[model samples]
Target: MKAFDWQLQKNGYIPMSGQIVDASLVSAPKQRNTEVEKEAIKAGKTGREIWPNEPNKAAQKDMDARWTLKMGGKIRYRSDGTSLPQIALPVFGYKSHIAVDRRFGFIRESALTSAVQADGRMLPRLVTTGNTSSGVWADSAYRSQKNETGLALRMLVSRIHRRKPAGKPMPHNIVRANAAKSAIRAHVEHVFAHQKNRFGLFIRTIGIARAMAKLILANIAYNFDRLVFHQRA
Candidate 1:
C-alpha cells in the first residue's frame, strides 16, 4: 500500500502540496457485563474465570474493545432563549487516524488504535515527512504546546486551530485564524463521510488486528475511487 501511494506521488497522480490530519471513531459492538462480572474483570480476573461454570465464556466477550465518550453536537437554543441539554454519546470501539493530501483528499497515512487513545498522540504517526514548506491543518483537538513544538522541529507549518481557554474568550485574531484554517481543514471530513456513507466502513470484527486490516482495505478502496474521480474531472 505504501509503495502504491508513493508511486502515485512520484508520478504526479497524488500531489504532495500539504496535508490535513483527523480521526474518526468506528463503533464496535458493545460488550455487556454484569456488575459482578465487571468487578471480577477489573480485579484482574480473566473473563473466562469470572464464570467458573462456563470456562469457555471468556471467548464470547470482545476483550479488545474499550468504551469512550464522544461529545454531542452544538446545543440549540429555544425560542425563549433556553439552552438544550448536551449529551455525550458512549462509544465502544476503535479510532482511525488519518493524514490526507490537501490537493485531492487522498489519504497518505493511517493508524488504528483503541478508543481510549488520544487523537493528539497519533499525530506523529499519521503525518508523513514531506516538504518543509507544506502546512498541516487540524482541529483544536490536536492543539498543544508539545505538538506545536514537534511540528516546528519538522519544519511543517502549524496551521492547527487555537483552543480557547476555559472561561476566557478567544482573541479576535485567533478566532479569525481558526475560521480560515477550518475552511481548508473541512475537506478532510468529506473523505470520512464518503467512507462511512458510501462504503459502510464500520468495523464488525472483535480484535484490533482485524479492525485495522478492514480499515486499511477501506482506505485503499477510497484512494482508487478518488483516482478514478480525478481522472474523470
Candidate 2:
C-alpha cells in the first residue's frame, strides 16, 4: 500500500504540498480482567507470560493491546455555567498516526503504535523532511519545545498549535495563531472521518501487525477513492 502511494507521488499524480499530521484511536475490544487478576498482575504475581502458558485464556486477552483514555470532545456545561467533569473513556487498542497531504488530502505517511504511546513521540517517524519542507500543521498534542527544535532542524515551518501555560488563559496572539492554524489543520480530519464513517475503519484484529495491516490498506483505499472522486469532478 505504501509503495502504491509512493508511486503516485513519484509519478506526480499526488502533489507534495504541506502535510497535516494527526492521530486517531482505533478501539479494540476491552480486555477482560477480574479485579483479583488485575491486582495480581499489578503485584507482579501474574504477567503477560501467563498468556502464553494458557492459550484458551490468552485468546480472551489481547497480549499486544494496551489501554488509553480519550477525552470527550466538548465540556458539558451546567445550568449555572459551571463546567461538568470531563470524561475520558477507556479505549484499548492502537493509535493510527498519519500524515496527509494538504492539497489532496491523501495519506502520505503512517505509523501505528499501541494506544498508550504518545502522539508526539511518533511524529518524527510519520513525518519526513523531504515532504514537509513546505510546512507541517498539527494540533497541540504534537507541540513541544523539542518538536519545535526538530522542525527547525528540518527547515520546516512549525504550524503546530501552541500550548498555553498552566493556570493561565492563552494570550490573545497565541489564541489567534491557533485559530489560524486550525483552519488548515482541520482538513486532516476529513480523511479520518471518511475512513471511520464511510469505510468503517476500526480494528478488530488482536495484534499490532494485523491492526497496522488493516489501517494501511484502509489508507490506500481512501487515497484511491479520493483520486476517483477528484477525477470525476
Candidate 3:
C-alpha cells in the first residue's frame, strides 16, 4: 500500500525501438555485469560463476517470464492523450498495487494486489470497509470501469437509498455527497503530482533495482521534510 511516482519506457529492459534502448543500460558498461547478476536473481536459479549445473540463462528466462506476464506490457500515450496500448508497470516494484483513497490520496491497505487495472478491485473494497454511510469520492479512473469488482462501490450506493421509506426513486443526495467528498479528495492527486514533478520520477532509470533503491531514499526524504519542518511550520 505504499505510494510513489513512477515512470514508463518502452524496451526498457532491452530497447524496443531506439538507439540507446534505455537510459540505465546505455549510461554505463558496468551495468552489463549488473544485468547479468539481476537476470540470475530474477531466474531464481544459481549462477555458474560458482558451481556446476547451477541455474543458468534458461532458468532466469523462465522466472522472468512469470513476472513479465504479470506486468502485462508497455504503456504509452498518443499525442492526444489516448492510451496507445494498455500496458502498465507495477509501481515501485510492489507485489500488490497502491491503495489510493477516494481523494486519490494514498491509503495503506493489504487487500490491494497486483493485477491488470487493480484499482478497479480496490476502490469498492475500501468503500465497503469504510461502510457506505459517509459516501465515497473518486476520480474517473474508478468510475470509468463498467464492472464493480470491489464491494465498496455497491455498499455506497445501497447506503444512499437505505431509507427509501416510500418508493422515491434514487435521490440527488448521493451526487451532492460525492461532490463534497471529491473536493477534499482531489488533494491526493496533487500529492502525486508534487512528488513526481519535484523528482525526476516520470522516466525509467538505468536499472530497476537501483531505481527502486533511489525511490525508497526519495520517499524517506519526502517524509522527513514533512515531519521535521513542513508539519511544524
Measured against the true structure, the TM-scores of the candidates, in listed sequence, are 0.87, 0.87, 0.36
User: In candidate 2, residue 154 scores what lDDT?
Assistant: 80
RMSD of each: 3.3, 3.3, 14.8
What's model 2's lDDT at 147? 87
lDDT of 3 by residue, 1-233 (tens): 13322211121211111010000001111212355566665556544442345555433321211122233544344545455556444232222222333322232232312122344445544442432133444443455334232334454331111221122333568556555555555544443454456754432333344444544554444444433442365
lDDT of 1 at 232: 90
lDDT of 2: 0.81
| Superposition error at 123 for model 3 (Å) | 4.4
Off-target runs (Cα >4 Å) in candidate 1 are: 39-56, 75-85, 131-133
Q: Which ten residues in a row have the lowest lDDT in candidate 3?
A: 18-27
Task: Single out the weakest 10-residue window by summed lDDT for candidate 1.
Answer: 74-83
Scored by lDDT, model 3 comes in at 0.35
Supply candidate 2's per-residue lDDT for 42.
Answer: 46
Error of 3 at 87 (Å): 18
* Candidate numbers, best TM-score first, in rank order: 1, 2, 3
Kindly indicate the candidate among 1 and 3 with the higher lDDT.
1
Model 1: residue 128 alpha-carbon error in angstroms: 1.8
Query: Which pairs of residues collide in model 2?
Result: none
- Candidate 2 weakest ten by summed lDDT: 40-49
